[model samples]
Target: MKVAMWSGPRNLSTAMMYSFAQRADFAVLDEPFYGPYLRLTGLDHPMRSEVLGDRRKDAIEVEQSLMDPVPDGKPHAYHKHMCQHMIDGIPRSFMAECVNVFLIRHPARVVASFAKGYPDLTADDIGFDAQAELFDHVRSLGQTPVVIDSADIRDDPEGMLRGLCETIGLEFDPAMLSWPVGPKPYDGVWAPHWYTSLHATTGFAGPEGPLPDLNGHLAELVARTMPAYRALETKKISQSMKL
Candidate 1:
């Protein structure tokens, strides 16, 4: 099975990828379309030149790679994707072929963590809008995309993971609970710029504290994203569910 897990930046996405990668049967791909998105948008992202050098900037080629055979004959493939990368030029056709799962985080937490890295950030830059659009698109295709909240996972990793695995028709594996510190072989070339904090941990962090205290622009950004966030939040797997 090819599992396409989608989310925006600063949403515990890397840690989720690490969790899945610990499984013997899963092959992981990190931010497959990042280079293409950077190339097409001409956005002045940090490490842009290095990212372009690591992966082909052609959208079609990147799409083809995602559809290719799972590496090393692994039984499943876990694709860690950033919703913002699905700009005009990137293709979404292959999503129908994979089990698409939307991973969401509260907008306040996203903005709090994100603002430190990108001061000029906009609402679209964080991907809440794009994620909602893609979630609807998946449903339009007659597919029920699974939605999981990062906060829930951190609160109860084992239970939430088991629930997620069952929902996606995969068995729960204890190995998914943790992975070694530092980068894995499949990490994208841009890991240094974005994944610095990820390297310091071996597992998901504990449940988050009260939402960050944001004022002014960050607060406005979170407010702008709440509708989209609540729309998806309502569909997330029940927190009380005892899987």
Candidate 2:
């Protein structure tokens, strides 16, 4: 089975990737299209030159890699993807063969965390709008894509993960709750710029309290993304499980 887990920046996407990587049955792929994304958008992210030099920069080639059989004969493949990377021209049809999952975080928290590294962030940079669009697109294709909020996972890792596993037709493995401290073979080249906090941990951290206020452009970006975030929240697995 192949699982395409889509998420925006500063979410628990990497930690989730680590969780799945702990499972012996899964092979994790970290942000495979990130290099191509930077190349296409001309975004001068940290380590841009190194990322472009080391990773594949063709979207079509990357998409083909995702469609191929699991690496090293693993039974399942867990692909950690950033929604913003799906920029113009990348084909979306491969999604039909994967069990797509959306990993989301509250807009306030996302903006607050994101702005620390990317001071010039816009709503598009955070990827909430892109995520909502992909969610609707997957649904329109008759697929009930799974959505999980980062807060829910941090609050109840076992329960949320077990529920997520079941929803995606996989058995919940206790290993998904923890992983070794430090990097793995699958981390993207931009890990140093974005994964500092994650690299120091072994598992999901506790939920953060009230986020600080957003002002100026950060505030505007949050306002723009809230609608999309809220729309996707209505379909999150935690909320749906209650009904």
Candidate 3:
């Protein structure tokens, strides 16, 4: 199936893609937007200097490059990119045949993760406000993108996986619950944080491990995002009933 996993940074977007790609039939495409987002935002990220090192002559060139045609071959392209704001330039038609999923975390947990792991990020830099805005935008657009909680997925992979499969009109595959963990080519830019948890374990495996602790900043972010997140969650739940 053609699928696009939409998310903000630091969520388990990459790891979830890994879980899906482990199945024999799926061919995965790593974040197709990393290069584009970098070009568009022009801010320095963790590996920003290296990723953008002399690749494009200028920002304009970078934008042009992303606007170019998508390279062919992969059937199941899992885009691991940020979606803080809408790019009216890109169309729903671009993803017409694909499944779109918005991976999310409790804003508090999400903010806490960014604060601890990526101290360089500020609230705006982490895009918490913007990401929340996108949830509202999706609702306004009337699209039923599957909204998966990063915490829920980490805690109960099987249940979340089954619900996700059912929502997308796909058959459940037990294999998605667990797989041999290691590095693969399509790993995200923030693989270090993700790989540590996602590396060795297979499947959702239930919340056997300690969860990340949220701090004040995370708490603040959660307070800001909860209403919208809950609304979207309910919208998704209602849609699932029809599907």
Candidate 4:
């Protein structure tokens, strides 16, 4: 199976990728579209030059790679993607070929965490709108993409992962519960700039704390994103669901 996980920045996306990388049968691909996104947007994100230097900047080549065979002869491939990177220029046809899942988090949590590194954050920078649109796109393709929340996973990694596996017709492997502290070979070149807190932990953090208080631009961002978050939240795999 090829699992394409779509998510925004600071939405527990890296940790989730680490979890799947620990699975023996899985070959993981990190942010294949990063180079293309940086090239197209010219946003000057942290380590922009290095990111552009690391790989093919063509969306065509990157999308082709996503559909190609998993490396190392693995039985499955897990592609970690940033929702924001699915720009108008990137093709959506390949999504129908894989099982797409949307990973989400509370807007306040996302804003609180993402704003530190990207102080001049915008709604598009967080990718909530794109995530929702992609969700609809997948649905339009006759696939009911699974949606999972970061807080739910952190609250009970084993139970949530087990349930996620079952929902997707995959066996629940105990190995997905944790990973070694620090980076894995599959991490993207941008890992250093984005994965500092994640690199220190072997497992998901505890359940998310109270929604952070926000004001000014940050508060406005959450407000704008909440509708999309809530829309997907209604369709999420809840803790009360089968496990």
Candidate 5:
């Protein structure tokens, strides 16, 4: 099965990618469209040139590759995708061939965490709107996509993952709980800029502390993103499990 795990920046998307990568049957692809996103938006992110230089700058090419057979004959392909990367002109037909999953984090936490690295963040940058759109689009096709919050996964990795596997018709693998503390061969070229904190961990970190105080544009961005976040939250898989 091809699983497209969609999330915005500063979420546990990378950690989830790591978890899935630990499974021997899964071949993981990290942010295959990130380069095209940067090129399309002209966002001057850290290592922008390097990102655009390393990965294909065509969204259609990336989508075609994603729909192709899983490399090395792996049974499953887990593609870590940023929701905001699905810009205008990118065809959504390929989504029908994949088991789509949305990975969300609280808007306040997402804004606070994302702002540290990207001070000029906007509502579009957080991806709440895009995620909701994707969720609805997939649902319109009569497919109930899975939605998993970062907190839920961190709080109970095994239980949440088991539920996720069952929902997607895959057997749960115990190996998804942890991985070696370092970058993987599949990480995007922009990892050095965004994966420093993730590289220092072997498993999901504990719950975060209080949300940071926001003001000005950051606070406004959070407000703008909350409605979309709430829309997706309604479909989030409950993390209540006795493990």
Candidate 6:
């Protein structure tokens, strides 16, 4: 199984990756696009190198490389990509084999975290619009992509994770709950805010402060993304009714 999990910023994406990695049969790859996006856009992100280090190849080179083909014959390969939007001028077929999951958080929470992590950025600067684009793009690909809510995952990890495994045709594994908590190599370069849950287990629980309240900016983002987010929710509910 080639699995690709997508999520907005500040979601428990990294922890979810850790969950999958706990399975002895699965090999995981953290955001392959982190490097390519930074290198391609030349954005001066705080953890620029950390995100893109493993993929420091030129952007055009990446475009060319992806155009070739994804190799077949891999089993239990889980690739986690924090995708907000599709890269322009790249082939969607490049990722045809992936079983897609979209992990989402409330915009209020997402914006609050963004504010804390980036002093210079406002909610306007964050790519909320890109998220809808991702929703539409993924919907166009598969019949039923698993859309899991981050809050639900955090609140009831066992049930949500068990259902997630069943949806993806994997046997439920309780071991995912107790994965060693710490930053692994594939973790985002800026692991502080993003990897907070992981670092908490390593004697750094002080950073697990209250979730910041949403400000005007985050409110705006929620309004913008609500339609797409609700659509995904409705789809999930409808699927569950049939099952």
lDDT of 3 by residue, 114-215 (tens): 676666555555554555565555555666567777767766676677788888777777777666667677665555654676677555545434545655
Quote the positional error of residue 104 for candidate 5 in Å. Answer: 0.9
lDDT of 4 by residue, 10-122 (tens): 99899999999989999988989889888888898998888899976599988888888889999999999999999978877779889999999999999999999989999
Which ten residues in a row are the worst by lDDT in model 6?
202-211
State the displacement of the C-alpha of residue 209, model 2, in Å, after optimal TM-score superposition: 0.6
* Residue pairs in candidate 2 whose N, alpha carbon or C atoms collide under 3 angstroms: none
Whose TM-score is higher: candidate 2's or candidate 4's? 4
Q: Runs in model 6 with CA error above 4 Å?
A: 49-53, 58-74, 122-128, 202-212, 237-243
At residue 106, give the lDDT of candidate 1.
97
Taken over the whole model, the C-alpha lDDT of each candidate is: 0.92, 0.89, 0.59, 0.91, 0.88, 0.63
lDDT of 2 by residue, 83-125 (tens): 9888897778789989999999999999999889988888888
Worst lDDT run of 10 residues, candidate 2, spans 234-243
TM-score of 4: 0.98
lDDT of 5 at 100: 95
**TM-scores, one per candidate:** 0.98, 0.96, 0.73, 0.98, 0.96, 0.79
lDDT score at residue 76, model 6, on the 0-100 scale: 77
Worst 10-residue lDDT window for candidate 4 reads: 55-64
Q: Per-residue lDDT of 118-140 in model 1, one digit per residue for the tens?
A: 88999979999999999999999
Ten residues in sequence with the least summed lDDT for candidate 5: 234-243
Off by over 4 Å in 5: 241-243
Better of 5 and 6 by lDDT: 5
Task: Spell out the clash pairs found in candidate 1.
Answer: none
Question: TM-score of the candidate numbered 1?
Answer: 0.98
- TM-score between model 3 and native: 0.73
Stretches of candidate 1 exceeding 4 Å from the true structure: none
**Which whole-number lDDT from 0 to 100 does residue 9 have in model 4?**
92
